[model samples]
Target: MASSDLVRRIVLLVVLCVSGGAMAQTGQDTSLVERGRYLATAADCVACHTTDPAKPFAGGVSIPTPFGQIVAPNITPDPDTGIGKWTDEEFYRAMHEGVGRNGENLYPAFPYDAFTKLSREDVLAIKAYLFSLPAMSQDNPVSELGFPFNQRWILSGWKLLNLRKGEMKPEPAQDDAWNRGAYLVEALAHCGTCHTPRDFSMGSDESRKFGGGAVGSWQAYNITPDPVSGIGDWSDDELVEYMRTGMVAGKGGAAGGMGEAVEHSLSKLPEQDLRDIVTYLRAQKPVRDPADEKPRHGWGAPSEDVSAFRGDETGDDPDGRAIFYGACSSCHGMAGAGTDDGEFPPLFRNTVVGARQANNLVMAILEGVHRTVDGETVSMEAFEHKLTSAEVAAVSNYVLKTYGNPAGATVDAAMVDELRRNAGEQPLVAKLAMPGLIIGVIVILALVFWLLTRRRRRSLR
Candidate 1:
């Protein structure tokens, strides 16, 4: 019980207490950053912002719109080109108000309208994670929109009609899980941006929410709860599986934009979140387009004609059956049935083949699929150069009639040729020509006004 011993023990206890406090603070900081990372993943910011695999978030992705192509800008911590110089307030305004650092309106292609529903804390967390990344000095390409479409002011008008600013309030009737799913799907995921048809001003058509819309050549299929046209028949498990792996046996696989979403975003999400998305989707009001009488995979029965394997070639033009034997029979069987393992899905009861529009099927034939699920690489070779447009049309027709909806058998060589020529091109509105005409008329009016003023001055003199 010496006085010296008591003093030494007291000093040691004080030192330990300070060290423990410091460690706890460090842990909190790490947790915040990790939370931010998870939020960014849920938001799927990397899909649009990161064009190159090597340069993640150093954005240069080309998003095509009816107006033109708008390249995504860098979001890296680079002070000059990226948002490194952005204040927290500036970043919030951009996300919540769809305004830039200089107070300019951002194109809806950025999906800020949906992002506006994000809470301030969530938006800041995303910013925090983005700032933590390595800065790249890459400058994004300028947008190629013509005339009035290129004008940023036009977006102000568009926003007044479409943009709904404010965080989503939970519905009193719904449970916490349902509300969470709704927020994630409608706000963060912005599924309506693609699935909902556009109005005259290019805003999403709320009346047909998740009832399907066209994105370039690809159709974002109806996801409403309609038994025939939408996903009402899809089991919860099937929906979750499709979101996770981008495929469901006897149904279909993802391609194009949906394919990209699966590869980059959906596949990377947690299983629970995927289930939540399905929950929200299932609760949607059933909407059916009159054109769709049944589910996409519920059409035509499989056919097995022996003439196809015999190379009969009886038709005036080369039949699709003969072409299938020569080119496609190797991977896909003579009967159009794929591998037993479901690595290559069977042609019958396939989503893509049975879709109301044959655009996806045609494009798949021309471009082919090359996506990786889990660790395995799933690929289908492109036949654009190998097969003539006529041959493609014939084979596509045969597959549609034999293994899919006969109504979808309307594709011709001319349609194939046009699809080939405009392969990677954006869908431009026919009204693009009208913009140039308007500008010309305005210029002529200005000149006429000037001439009249000059004549008046001369008369006065």
Candidate 2:
């Protein structure tokens, strides 16, 4: 053969060798991607990432934040619209380091604080899952935060204040179940996102921990071990039942964002994983916030008499009557007779009215009742702000004295002021009390600074 022909043959061989090496790398990448898929599922990536059924992972879900509204972004492998061209290192930086593919900082609205506990390998697994999804062409609108918050540079400063980088550490003292739960809660489940309180600066209050925080229109309750205000009152069986079925006897059912979380993410958790979460939470430190422990109404105790005003004294409170007619008349009925709304438990029925305490009744008025909706029993909205305190007192007293029993004490204007003050000061310990036990693990796991970040310099200051 000629020299030119021989040289061409050699070049072809070199090309084949390069092609073979590329294929091998691709195979390893595919395996990692598969692992990431599982991790993302456990993390409930779909809950916030995908808003439209036609475009999965094309994030545009509007999440309410304390400062403003945040819109999640499309994470598919779309070249123009998603993270399609991002390198593995870029993905790692985003997850473990809280940086974007372009080297800019990410907003903590993504819950990277909890995700920081995720191993690099685990984060890559999630990236793999994200890349495997069908790319969405639709572009999402930017967030609707106010002026200063809308600036991306501000997020970097926020990260400096709050962001941490690390992986979850196995607690040696705890069993495998607790360890697994800690991992899930701290890394994937991120239960503290809602249960934990935030400082005025909007960072998680490490001091108060899962003490509670107000987010947009909703208030996150405390999940500590306080008996009167926290889960100390909840039995293990009751906790399990709530996680499994989303119902608690007196507290209330899940509604709003909570209901969505239960349906999209929690319902998919494995039974063993759920149990682990419960175990880890049950083992947490208890909080002692007396403000959270007090009952909704000070019913049974021999406190000041609120029975001075029974019904319409002047008969001029039109708004009060209208509120009662529009909202409370269904199961409560025109005559306040208990209907078939489950044991529609008469409003004036039993100790709720007769007890010296009026807190139980006040909470009921502020936080409206919930029953079956769309054939499913769902939690309803609390209308504390919707109606005036006198309206609440008037309607409450009307139900108590007229419908169920005469032994019930009447509610008054002064009593309304006291109830509002108490309700407004609700602690995080109280909110976390009603949910599953995993809440505690999430709160505490965030506190383990040394164990989480393997490298000292890698830690969040």
Candidate 3:
């Protein structure tokens, strides 16, 4: 071949190799972004960050806290209103140290204490996935917090008390699956943020890990292996099925935060990952409360009140049995034995009904069950508008007596009224905050009145 022809051939080979290398790099980037998206789902990031399904991660969701409502910040790639300008280092810091890009302290509500355990690579992968999304430019509203909480500077002191910054280390004795489960549970899932109770300063009580905590308007049930109060008797399959679909035959259903986690996160996760989580939970130290009773799913039998509905259709008296015939009987059956396939789960042997605390059950009645698994949405219509509070209480008591834990059958209209306030109480901080604010206002008015009198006397002179 001529020298020019040989040179042309060599140049063509170099161009093809370069093209192949670029294509390989793009493939890797796509894979990383996909992995990050999975991790984001596992983290249930959408639960707090996105209010509207159409504009995910744009972060205008309002999270109710004892202090006040905490608004989720935008994590989308909008340079103006989102974290688009954030460097990988800044993102990692937010995850690992509970610190924001501008070095502001993030509230514990974000659960950075758990994110702190995530590996640097995992954190960056999550960031990569977040950045890959369409840059949403919606502005996040300021968190509606009370005095001390609104003062971001106070959060620094909170961090010192609660934050534990570091990556999770694998336990050598455990097998790979167990270790994987541990990582997913302790870090990515951040289950402790909901399962573990908070201390006085509102930090998760690590000592009481998985002992069950309260979320907005719902109780995060005890997941510890205690036989009475927790899931000790729950078989691995039961736990897995419940986590995967928010429903397991004769066990319980997930509602509130748990329902969201199931629909958006757990149900979509790889099966092995879920099995690993169950393994880790099983291995944790069992925690039991002194007031513990039988397992939540171990309560009740078929309602004998079946006889009440058997008679002539009762007059429009809105008592528990009357309401059950009218509203509940169509799905749950007259015997309270739910549908054959467990589509409509039996109120008996169910957590919401059998739980010692009536909060979750009442909330469910008012708000109703809504969870999606495998792209199918399962929902129960909410009765907040349809039923009076007294009617809710009556039906709740009847369900508890006939089909659930008789111990928890003590619900009343007054208790239902309280639960109607969205299932949470004012935090100690907010409870104290309002009174202190009132006192401060009174003192300021007194000072102003004294000053006005002094000015009047001077004018008279």
Candidate 4:
């Protein structure tokens, strides 16, 4: 062979080797990115971060707390507006310490308290997946809060009391499945964030873990193994079905935050993960509330005369019967039997309607249900713009009386108006009774500090 041809062959070999190495590196990166994507899904990051489906991760979600409305910031990789400029360490700190890139304390609304239990490897993986996304330039609205609540510095004090900053360790005594379930429920899913009642500091009430709590207009019902207030009566199959479809016939269906969760997170989870969650939930200590002696679906007798109650549509003020017939009867029959195919659920034996509190039923009428399951979209058009508050109250009361819990029959127009106004807002303990206490404590601390400084100055003089 000629010397020139031999040299060219060597060059070709070197180029091939370099190309192969680059391909191997690319494959490894892709695997990590995919793993990150799965972890993010498990965490349900998109539920809070993405408000607009068209602009996923370009956050503009308004999260209401006792302090005020804190908007979720963009998590996309946009250099100017999103986390694109964030280093891996910064992202990890935000997850593990609830601190921002600028060293400012983040509000607990981010759920970093639970996220702190995540392994450093998992946290970094989530960051890696987020960084792999296309950059989106979306500016989030500034949080609008009242007085001392607006002060982010207050979170530092709050964190000192509530933040359990550490990664979760697997229980050695438990089987691998149980351990996995425990981690998913406690760390990744953070179900207690909604289900557990809050203390004065707005931390999850560990004593009442999964013992039902209110989330804005919706109720995050008990998931413990209690037969009365919780899911003790539910079979593993029933629990799995509910998690996957957000509904189980003769039981109840999910709406509001729970519905959003089913639609965006739980429904898409792997079947084994769903089973694991169920297993963990079933093992929880039953914390029964007397008020929930029976499941929501078990309350409320069906109205016998619903079919005969058509009203005068031509009248100036149509009665609930007329409104029901005109607007809701087509999907939910005159007898509230719902569609036979189960696409439109029966109002009778429905958990939302049968619940002791009428808030969910009222909100459903006003906001309507919109969820997707198994590639099919389920929607109920919102009536907020269409019906007057009084009209909504009337219709809701009618449904409650005719097909649901009679206790809910007392809902009035004023109640509907209140629910409408505070639609998606979260209840803050500080707003409830802590504000005055917090102020008083601050005042006492300030006075004590002032006296100490004065004494020190006098001694120096």
Candidate 5:
């Protein structure tokens, strides 16, 4: 061959080699799809995507972010409404590069940063499971973001600063179980999406990995191995039970977002996987000591603060008596003998009063309870509305102090404000009457107008 021809042939050979390797890396098969299914579950994809059972993978689950509400997109195999038409390469690009099928950058709400740790093979597995799901032709409206956040181009700049592109690499020093747990927790599970704190710019602060996070309406507590502020004191079994059933022995049961996670994802996981998670958590680095951290003045105490709130106020105990008579006595009974069949269970006998930590009572009181009644969730109606923060605090303090357990924490007014803020109650409640009431009235007026018009037409005939 001539020199030019030989050079061209060599270049062609190199191109083929690179292209072949790329194809091998992105290849999709049955096994890969199955792996993806497992990964998606581990990542809690269903918790957000398949929120409404009737609308599985159809997407309309609104996730509250500081910027605005973000809705997870349909990833099912629907050509028009889902990712049915997306090429394998396109899928890879989205998972690895954080770019959409058409090259638009996806918002970090999808947690591609942590997902970026997943191998191409792992991401492909997730894609397979999503595609295998029954596709629905639902078109969820895009979020109504305010100001600069609505711009898609801004995410490109976000990528430049925060996105670190790579795959998971195991720590060789760790055992196989620990390594597996680490990969699942840090990458597939994307636990950091909720647990890790974010900076002002809206990216997770790696320095505080597994530290507490305050998203729009929910607070994801720190799960670091910290003895106080984190899960340092929890045993392996406690961790497993918490993950599997959303209940820990002394720490209280899961509620809110955590409850949902347990119901959808964790509950279905194999026992071994739960054990691995516990092992991994136990081995994690402690973020902070609870004692060293500043004490939160208001919220229900974790146990130690009970005495300060109690004092030598036997006379005030009757005030506690009156409050209980007014509110709790109906269900719990005046003598604190819990109701039969564990329904309206006694205050003295209940786990909340007996818990080593006070989070259960604090959360239950602040958020309130709802037992399933006649196929519908019957809410007991939270006193959060009727009772003052101080009143609620005082009542809770009184219950723990007098009835069955030691005194409750020093949950003052300021603590109430903080909890209310964290729950996103104040903002939503303030606007509830404004829009709903007005809309209801308008709907009634429109119906009346239609009825009047129909009557006039009949009379004319």
Candidate 6:
């Protein structure tokens, strides 16, 4: 080993030796909060939990699902409004069994299924780290769920079917790097919570693991080793670069939840850890989708049509070409070629534009792009307020045909309007919740009336 590595190890050993007894007694080391902080970042806890950076982890951020919006609760150490009173065991149960402090069934929205894979030591460490933060009292917003969704009892059934609690076991045959990567990917990172397709009950489908799933307003594309449908076409370097930098030009760029993960979690990870992740991903079974005849990022070409721009005064009707020229052509060239350095990516072959669906492309227009890492930031301005729904659809369609996959031209003004309203595909539970609630209510009312009538009749007799 290098001299620097030896020195670092020695220093760590000395510190542990001095503090080990206290650590064992308290089951926490304040000095160890740094480790907890790193793990929390790996879990990307702040992304969902913190709405305001000033009051970190005083959660009220709305996490939108097809069923409804779940407001993340405050995790800061405030006794009244947060988890300050929770024992380490209580916190562990919440993580390991999806049960809250008061023994309430917590929502799957907290992603406890993945957390269940975390070891008790790690869970406590995360808690210790959270507790180490400044306690801030912030009342959690009640979840805005419809009908039966607002009921928590159903989560018990959901858990029985889907929850698998266990620490990640190392594959004996694999190297240490691969094992570490597996734990990081499965437990801390919980990539499957977003990247894997969901079953009928809205739990992840392990059969089609890493086959591609959807986050709100964006599709999490396949990352398995399938050439056409997944990242098999990408080099190891490309994958690592994308994880660290959030964009590997001419291939894919992160946006939405993926962007958040990259910016907050993946980008901060050590290079070796990123490589290990790539290594583990490389070993996964390649899942191919018949729909992908070509790569999602493989389609598209620079536009050659200059004739459409010759007209001077635009009419009342929304013109996509005119809109794109007015707004987009400055950063991305008239020919759709970005900068030589790819600071502004070329439209052609962008993963967002050439996706199987146009949802992400539309979202990108509305949300824009801003990912910062390594002291550099890549940005795009959001046009949601600036552009009308019709104009957004028009421009999206125009980009699709001229510079991206023509099949992605499915966006219309109505679809854009709907996306603005609610930005996710309806899950099975969401589809059933309304009818289920109505039937349940009717049954309860009938039972109550029958009981009341019988009691009155008996009393009269």
Query: Which candidate achieves the best lDDT against the true structure?
Result: 6
Provide the clashing-pair count of each candidate structure: 0, 23, 1, 0, 6, 0
Clashing pairs for model 4 are: none
Q: Which stretches of model 5 miss by more than 4 angstroms? A: 1-32, 289-461
As a TM-score, model 2 comes out at 0.65
Write down the lDDT of every candidate, Cα atoms only: 0.83, 0.65, 0.87, 0.84, 0.68, 0.87
Steric clash pairs (candidate 3): 217-423
Candidate with best TM-score = 3
Q: Give the TM-score of each candidate.
A: 0.88, 0.65, 0.90, 0.89, 0.67, 0.89
TM-score of 3: 0.90
lDDT of each residue in 1-461, candidate 5, tens digit only: 79999999999999999999878766645567768777788888877776567878888778765456778888778899989999888998888888999878887888889888988877777878888778788888787555456778978877887889989898899998998888878887788888887764567778888877655445567788876567776677877877876654335545566766776678778888888777787776778834433211111222222233334466543244456557776776666554454445455534456433344465566777653322334234467777777676677767776543453455566666666544332333224535766788899999999999999999999
**Candidate 1, residue 281: CA error in Å?**
1.6
User: By the TM-score metric, which is better: model 1 or model 6?
Assistant: 6
lDDT digits (tens) for residues 1-461 of candidate 4: 99999999999999999999999999988988898898898888898899888889999898766566888999999999999989989998999899999999998889898899999988888888999999989888998977777888988888998999999999999888888898899889988888888776778889999887767667788899987678888889989999899889888778888888888889989999999998888888899887665777776554445543556556665377667877888888767888888888888888888777888888888888888988878788789999998888778877888888877777777888878765344446555546677789999999999999999999999
Off by over 4 Å in 6: 1-31, 310-317, 440-461
Could you give candidate 2's per-residue lDDT for residues 28-78 as a string of tens digits? 888888777767767878878889878888999877653456789889999
Q: Could you tell which candidate, 1 or 4, scores higher by lDDT?
A: 4
Regions of model 1 farther than 4 Å from truth:
1-22, 309-318, 417-461
Clashes of 3: 1
Model 4: number of backbone collisions:
0
lDDT tens readout by residue for model 6, 118-148 = 9888888898899999999899879998767
Q: Where does candidate 4 stray beyond 4 Å?
A: 1-13, 306-322, 423-461
- C-alpha RMSD values across all candidates: 3.3, 13.6, 4.3, 4.0, 14.7, 7.1
Compared with the true structure, what per-residue lDDT tens digits does model 3 show for residues 1-461?
89999999999999999999999999999999998999999999998899889999999988887777888999999999999999989999999988888888888889899999999999999999999999998987798876766988988888888888899999999899899999999999999888998777778877888999999768998898888888899888888888898888888778888999999999989989999999999999998988766788888888746565554355553578778878888888888888998788888888888888888888888998898788778888899899998889888888888888877778887888877775376656556766888899999999999999999999999
